[model samples]
Target: MNKFNMTAIAVAVGLIFSAGMMAQTMSKDDYQAAEATIADKYKADKANCDSQSGKQQDICIAAAKSNKNVAKAELEARHEPSAKHDYDVVVAKAEADYAVASATCQNKSGNDQDVCMKEAKAVETRIKADAEAELKVLNANKTAGKEYTETGMKEKAEMTEARQEAATDKLEANYAVAKEKCDALKDDEKDSCQDAAKMKYGK
Candidate 1:
């Protein structure tokens, strides 16, 4: 129920997710073993969640699911390290974070909850946008990296465009969170808040 406890659960799951990503190419036996390990971990996580009640339990369940999802995605990333798979890993991480954030927001009410949800969304958006940019950059790097061929030039351009678009997406998400916070204010204050957000984000 406490913030630190929830955060610890999230961090613990995330650490496992990170470690899963570092796995090298595996033999059939190794892959199966890892797969089994993931399954066992998920079961253990779920069992731990069973000890809590109500909203705390829901958050625990969400965290457990997040852990399982990220583990699965990381497993695939390890099994096949491609732009698409790597992107999947990032997506998993984003979703995992969002799940926990959304669950935690239940602790708040009214505008506080709204802001919490919006902030969660902003984080998700940034992560997903980064994933997209990273995937595009990886695809672009499929070309002659660091070498100045015509194709390389095109690849570099694509990479730059992807990153720019991701940055724009992040900015827009931030603006949304700012605007959502303005909802807590009244009339002129709210209007000024929104105006400032628009100016800050170039919305």
Candidate 2:
């Protein structure tokens, strides 16, 4: 799809990968294996930078180092899933991106370099802010859902109580009317009429 969608998908894949790993029982062996993988990849990536010289070499080395750091952070996060760990992953990615962008900016000179660095920082800040805002919104929606559910249950209970009270009042009013009619009867007949009213009204 679009660039933003692609970037989001990539990041989501990484997080999903971590979540899958976390779903399993993590062990010391897993941790050591992850560390070894990162180290090997980093070494290979750094070796690629040796072919270049000057600023190009510096940029390549920076990118390799950034990638290594981000990988390690992601591995650690997967090993221990927590809010702080997740946040660390986000922060790591942001810093890595900034490092790459900043290194690339060094390839420029004079006023152009200043503008490049400024733009890089601006983008980094915006990305980080957006991430924080998304986290806050997610938490807020969860809280609101809980509150709405509780309120709904309370209101349902109150409505049920009100209905029961109204039924009782209606039954009493009906029994009063029946008793008034029974007043027209005499002695034993009146007692029989009152008994019928009591049975009909469940008094």
| Cα lDDT of model 2 by residue, 82-123, tens digit | 545555667677777778778888988865676566555555
Per-residue alpha-carbon lDDT of candidate 1 for residues 82-135, written as tens digits (9 for 90 to 100): 557667776887788789889989999999999999888887787678767766
TM values, all candidates: 0.83, 0.58
Instruction: Give the local distance difference test score of model 2.
Output: 0.66
Window of ten residues with lowest summed lDDT in model 1: 9-18
Residue 59 of model 1: what lDDT?
93
Instruction: Tell me the spans in candidate 2 whose CA falls farther than 4 Å from its real position.
Output: 1-25, 136-145, 148-203
Error of 2 at 125 (Å): 0.7
Model 2 poorest ten-residue lDDT run = 1-10
